[model samples]
Target: MAEQRMPLPPLLLDGAEYHADPIRRALSALAGDRAGRFAPGDLAAAMGSDYTMTVTPGRASVPAPADGTGGVYLVESAAPVTLAVTPPHATRDRIDRLVAYVVPAQAGGTPGAWYLAVREGEPAASPVPPAVGAALVLYDLWVHSAASGRPIELSDMRLSGGQQMLAGGTLAGAERPATAPAGTVWTSTTTRQSWAYSGTAWRLLGVQDDTLASHALSGSRAWGPGVNEQAVDNLTFGPGRNGGLIELSAGVVHLSRPGRWALSMQAFSDDGTPGSSKVWLDWPGGPWLTRDLCDTRMRGGGFAGAGVLHQPISWTGVVTSDQALNAITIRGAFTPSTGGNRPSYMVWLYVDYLGR
Candidate 1:
């Protein structure tokens, strides 16, 4: 359908003759058909044409409104608000979409209102051909980036077509189909799961679950009795095989997002009078807190088993911080009951990441 018009209101004011309702002229371009509205600039850039859009009492609005029979339809506003939209079917897609937004009204001017309309559906082909572009949204959620149009089909949530799907006879017997095609898949006799074919072979259309079950170890480092030190360990700890997120030198870790993080450590120390090892939280430029890990038991008898002692310690704590762009430093120190002995070495530091 084309743009349609509504009856114009009489140009009169409070008990006297006057100009048109300032609201009506502001939205003069809108009508029942060609219900679409746009600013002069958007139309020029997108379609190389000059156009203005207006609305009726049911369409004029202040805050942008959603399209439908419901919601607050724009009847009037305090200002003349402008809106812009790209022509529908600008790219090759099964359906076209119309989008609009309201611009803030001009300062120190008569307040105006506009029609709020958003649309998406299969419509008549456009008079103008699709524009050349790098990417275009095909269906509601489908996307294509190449200029060359190729069919990459998604079969029952599994993707196939020019790429990877295959068919190995998995059904009952000779009566069963031989190969799974591009867009259609068949159930397997073995696993009984649906499979689709690409250029290569048939692949499964299913979900998978991967668990983080293994323990990743960090290389050990030593600490003295009276001086502050970093319990250096292998920094190979992060998402999958990418490596860890924490720094071994500065002991700083730049977080991807803020959430709950748990750190657990099992350590061993050399012979000494034996004392507690302290672990501190360093948010770098933020707050600092310490956790005292107990010395547990002291065992010795070296120098042919004379003064040799070993103390086992465990440290665990939870940290909650803000999202990205924040950094953390974990600091540690060992306090010996007596001086002159290298009392500690961090053996293992296990980290667990959890969401809030």
Candidate 2:
């Protein structure tokens, strides 16, 4: 007789063979028809053995079956089992089942407030909320003109507090230093003579003659309104009977005494003739004689004298026939010489008051 062989229990075959294959596979088979489920021992074995299983709740294991079919069955007197399986890659459709949900609060009761923070070895987090009542700051982004290739263009422009604004037509309050216009010209006149404020110090522009003789001439002589009076006198002497004699005297005699004088003369031969004798005298007399009178035969043999004199002479007391005398002579004589025979003689005698 063959030993009676009870039919192998289905659990004893493939489905019930818990110790035959990996614990995760047997438990996964037993969690029948659920989206995700897990057993404790299976979860620990999967994590410890492979380190690739995901043991998070509601992540990878299926739920327990309601009909007790194809689920992890705890046999009588057997420790409960846990099974772990690799979770599927996260998908938009399964995100709610796999991931936790977190809702963020609004900032200042307004939307659109957002920030980001990055950390090492971890996922980045959102930034903190901004202060209340704060204004939004913005940067100045310059935009150039496409046609002109410039940032700005205008006839007049202005700036205030780092911001530029356009001016309407005119600049009313703008203050600037005075400036000369283009092509501006200035003119003035200058003179060579010295000038004074009262117009009195300016001299004549051309040559000026200030001499007394030049002032006395009849031409257009410019004269200042000041007094211009001049006087001169002259007297002269020569060799006469008494060795030396006062030959000629001429001057501008004033009433009491003359102030201005000038005279000239020449003499030749011992005879006193009109053309043979010439004489002149000025105040402060002397033998102011020129030319050789010793050789009387030469046509030019005569004494010549010419000079200018300024002296004071008396002219009030007595008069004489000789015009050279200033006054009457108390004692004097005139001896006339014979032609080419005797020596000539000239006498000048007069007396007058020597006035101041």
How many residue pairs collide in each prediction? 28, 32
Model 1 clashing-pair count: 28
- lDDT of each prediction vs. the true structure? 0.35, 0.22
Q: Once superposed on the true structure, which residue ranges of model 2 sit more than 4 Å away at CA?
A: 1-275, 282-342
Model 1, residue 356: C-alpha shift (Å)? 4.2
The regions of model 1 sitting more than 4 angstroms off are 1-215, 223-251, 272-330
Could you say which candidate leads in TM-score? 1
As a TM-score, model 1 comes out at: 0.31
lDDT of 1 by residue, 235-346 (tens): 4443452223222334444443234445555554454344445544344432224323333343433332333433333333334333223454444555555555544454
**Structural RMSD, model 2:** 55.8
By summed lDDT, the worst window of 10 consecutive residues in model 2 runs over 212-221
